[model samples]
Target: MSQSKITPKSYKVLAVDDNEDITELLEYTLSKEGYQVKTTWDGSTAIQLAQSFLPDLILLDISMPIMDGIEAGRLLRQIPALDYTFLIYLTARVEEYAEVAAFDIGADDYLIKPIKPRALVSRLKALLRDKNELAYSSTEFRIGDLKIDSLSYTINYQNKVLQLPKKEFELLYFLVQHQDTVYTREQLLSHVWGAGMHITPRTIDVHIRKIRERTGFDYIKTVKGIGYKFTTEPENT
Candidate 1:
């Protein structure tokens, strides 16, 4: 609520962090970039704010009391008002291990902290630009018993909606793009995450596990030690 920067043209950014100082920094920095910024000191209020405003993107902090950024992001994705909003994890922890788990929880991008004001602005702008483009692209695709509505950001299996985390939905979307064609973890990471990050092969394993828990993991085929492929439709699962 404390203002130090001029609001952006008209974009809304929900900045959530348990640390008041960090949320203030994000609000100050992003507002200067012309974004209408709102701040929450906890994930609970972050979800409320998101439910009300439905921001174009969320700047989420990884470490927080109660519900963490991962849980917050997951909850926000379920809110119909904020379902399609992009989520970026803002954190001081950039170690390889945490980074993988962060993405597995469904962050579009993870930014290492001590972030320069201008650099952060640039990244936000780029993310917004790309997201806007993808939004208008075809959002619905159907294959056998698997169906995805891109705009809704929801997936259905045999007409029964499947509860998948953001990353799981994205991974499935990518694999379905080339059905029956196996893609390596390296390939999956590159295509899904882009070359902007350095991540491990195990990242794929974690998400695949979560995916299986919700809808049985075997549908996503693992080539022993290689990559994964979307092998069977629900009818085939």
Candidate 2:
């Protein structure tokens, strides 16, 4: 008897943008790529739908009525159930400060407006691929007093459970995986954020700062005139 062929699961993508045209384009384009796509016109409605839909990825816009994407992202981060969902901000804001703020708020990638359809699709595919790879790679990691469980996307820090955004967790995990290895800002960006992504190296600094603040440990060391390193031997220890 011949075995039946098995098909891979399609990724679920939720797009929240006020522009009908953009949403329609995303739906049509993503649908063609075999993704389960859903669209909402506002952040408030998007949040409500997200709880039920539980999408694997979210394409969010920063400006909208009712609620903006930043507020929505803040609220979503508070929900433990949605911790693993990848968020990409699609906005027209090209300011460096705005990009920094978006990254600070847990955005995995920020794509400025006037993006090419094919490029957007390629980026989405890359993000989903990376996410899937991380999910299936490993589940548990222990470094000093910091315990990281990729399966639950939670970190046990000094007996307290802390939830880090996807990018932050990935960054920490990568650094911890290669303890004492100093990675330049550019190298870290390529490794963590993926290559071809239009993000400044300073973005890495912001994420590192956040991780330091949350963990209350200066394990990530900065080498002057270079980049950063994750040292098992933390300073002031």
Candidate 3:
């Protein structure tokens, strides 16, 4: 079965690569697909452009002169205006550690080089679709002293506002909404990250840890030999 092609032209993309040819290819291919594309050959310029362009997605190369995608991604995450912007590392690095590091630094997706244009477009469509669906699903949630506002993508804990990365916030929201229901890693992966995605289950743990650290809340209960649950009655409360 073939799925219908979604509108790609409505989105803006920022492509950053040290190789001019790669950037050119990205610009040409994405432009042909109707996307508003901008290209940069250096990470520093990519960062600067991102502030004004405010792209919906960023295609970054891990190895670049003057600055690298990892550093650039870290800095981008700190920008409140770009908090919801999708970030993808499009590089040639194949090491597992590199992939893990990219996600740790807040990349929404990671792709290797030599990819087919059709496949790249498909990936982008899927990512954007998932993002939009998540955005429209729910608007706000309140659990105990924690409050989540999906529109702003911000959380309030004990009246203190704390901003979370996109994935972390989604994970926390999902668990809190279904409080006390035990969810296995696989279930969490499906519900929070979208079904059939290549993301690892351990990624859930990383987000969970970050949520705990940021909120200083003990509401998420780890079920041994199973998974985790968000409890209404937090331990030691």
Candidate 4:
């Protein structure tokens, strides 16, 4: 643990995989690093544990017998208590679309298989550090009948309350805060997901599509051959 960053012991981690050997290894590795870790060999059990444990981070595997990682991740995001929890996929899937699907399901980060204990810890540390900084940013956006509150991590639209997945919310927040400004996919990737993220531009498209699906197309406008922008008024059809 780094003195300059929050202590690992302060964070709880849930590691889910169908392989008992993998889970045991994860438990041993993460526990040795001072993090409070809980492990389960299946997604169903993992979901149950998460409800009770409410871990700050989850390292999930994409392949499982009964319920896969994608389904588990989706259900986890639906848990209001776990909305802010960081999810990193640990899988052997190398297809580009697989990564895109992970992002679409609100994953915070994605790491391919063959987990490296030290590197995994470092990634967790970085995500945890970012979480700390985000806590201090008091951001709320009000435009017309819509309101976005970073504090509550909720969106108020037309007297209705909505909660989007973490990535979708952040993407929408960024576009709204910089309303009417056209940004290419690359630029949005840099500003929203950070420059170091390995996600492709297609991931941005998936996020944007999800955002539009939840909130409707009235807020986000596509620039046809360009990218996306946020607008308060409806665009001409």
Candidate 5:
């Protein structure tokens, strides 16, 4: 998993390229960093891999046989279930159209083909760093009695531990890290799911319920027309 490589935690990465050499290079490069990576030449299998891997990031090639990267990306984005997968594209040097298309379809970044293995690794590390930073910039937050580690993804309450599923953990981490900030379903979907994933806005509600049930954060407030907020400090009545 991508997370495992960088943070000693489970994180997965999916790399797609019709060229065996390119796929192999990416897998080798990323794996050297202790990242768990999966790669394939088949674009049709992209969605299936996504569902199974729940990758932290996907590096997709723009051109391929059978199914193209654009189509694969569109399909992934249309699922309305995977809300947290980041996407980057590998394009030929002359493929300007593919670059534009990659961004239009929701790719966060793009790299020219015949990639420098070292450079690719560097970019991935930088991307992950920014992601972690943006997701957990807060100093501290308490949702009810639950205490969350902004950097570690560890949670505790009243000296008791609370375990969470992969997606659930990420969602709760985001909410508590940004306590007191009201976030709409779409915003949460975008940030948590990533631009590469297609997810319904209402999925937040389900995760919210799951979060409330699993932890002591019974005080998570709903804004009705908007979304939810977890306030560490109680409101003055």
Candidate 6:
């Protein structure tokens, strides 16, 4: 069975930018598109608001006083409640490293600023659509002693709870669901990141490494010349 499409009104967005004008534009644009919107001027305030608002997506500006988006994103990623929240960077920084830093902190997407409201809304809709598709069934399942609860996005191993960032969780969940089916990096990107998303194949490797670090190498195994897969058999590590 396919998941139902999420309506715009059912979506909530938080826009954070030091520029009042840009925030106002974001509010106006997204609101008109039927999303519930909140605006904040600084990263700290955005974090506070996110805890209460629990927004489905965040439009964050990379440059802001008191706290920058990168720091805010890192902290936000640590919040288990916001683990699945989509974070997109709205910044003027066009440097390659800046984009790398954003992705390193778990950014879902990045938009270089000129504040094109319509295009931004399009991106948000696409992202939310992809998220809805990735949403797992509410049921929880176990592979040996490892427990993955789709409802709360929690992983329990050996009676201890483990939390991974959003992307990592999705990647691991996908592999576990399709145990023993080896997937190439490009295939994993399309399946997990969704089609047309600007994620590269290398991003898959990075996420795979992190997943191993957090959950150990028992489940997901790399196929030397191919890609990776989840297996019930013990890895020969």
Q: State the lDDT of candidate 6 residue by residue for 1-237, as single tens digits.
A: 965667999999999999999999999899999999999999999999999999999999988999999999988887878877999899998776777677777877777889777777887887787566556457677988888876677899889898777777878888998999999998998887666655556777777777778877567788987898988886853
> Which is the winner by TM-score between candidate 4 and candidate 5?
4
- TM-scores for the candidates: 0.75, 0.90, 0.85, 0.86, 0.55, 0.80
Candidate 5 on 1-237: residue-level lDDT in tens?
333224813567899988888888888888888789999886798888888778888888877888999889877766545555667777784455555455555555666767888777777776687666645564455555677765544578888876554345667777776777998988886776565433445457766776677775565678889997766664421
Q: What are the runs in model 2 whose C-alpha is more than 4 Å off? A: 1-9
lDDT of each: 0.74, 0.85, 0.83, 0.84, 0.70, 0.83
Estimate, for each residue in 96-161, the C-alpha lDDT of model 1 and write its tens digit: 777776766666777888767887787777666654544556567777677887655677876788
> What TM-score does model 1 achieve against the real structure?
0.75
TM-score of 4: 0.86
Q: Among these predicted structures, which one has the highest TM-score?
A: 2
Which is superior by lDDT, 1 or 2?
A: 2
Model 5 TM-score (2 dp): 0.55
What is the lDDT for 169 in model 6? 82
Residue pairs whose backbone atoms clash in candidate 4: none
By lDDT, the best candidate is: 2
Model 3 global lDDT (CA atoms, 0 to 1): 0.83
Give me the displacement of residue 107 in model 1, in angstroms. 3.6
For model 6, state the Cα shift of residue 169 in Å.
Answer: 1.2
Error of 6 at 170 (Å): 1.0
Q: Write the per-residue lDDT of candidate 2 for residues 181-202, one digit (tens) a residue.
A: 9899999999988888889998
TM-score of 2: 0.90
- Model 1: how far residue 39 lies from native, Å: 1.9
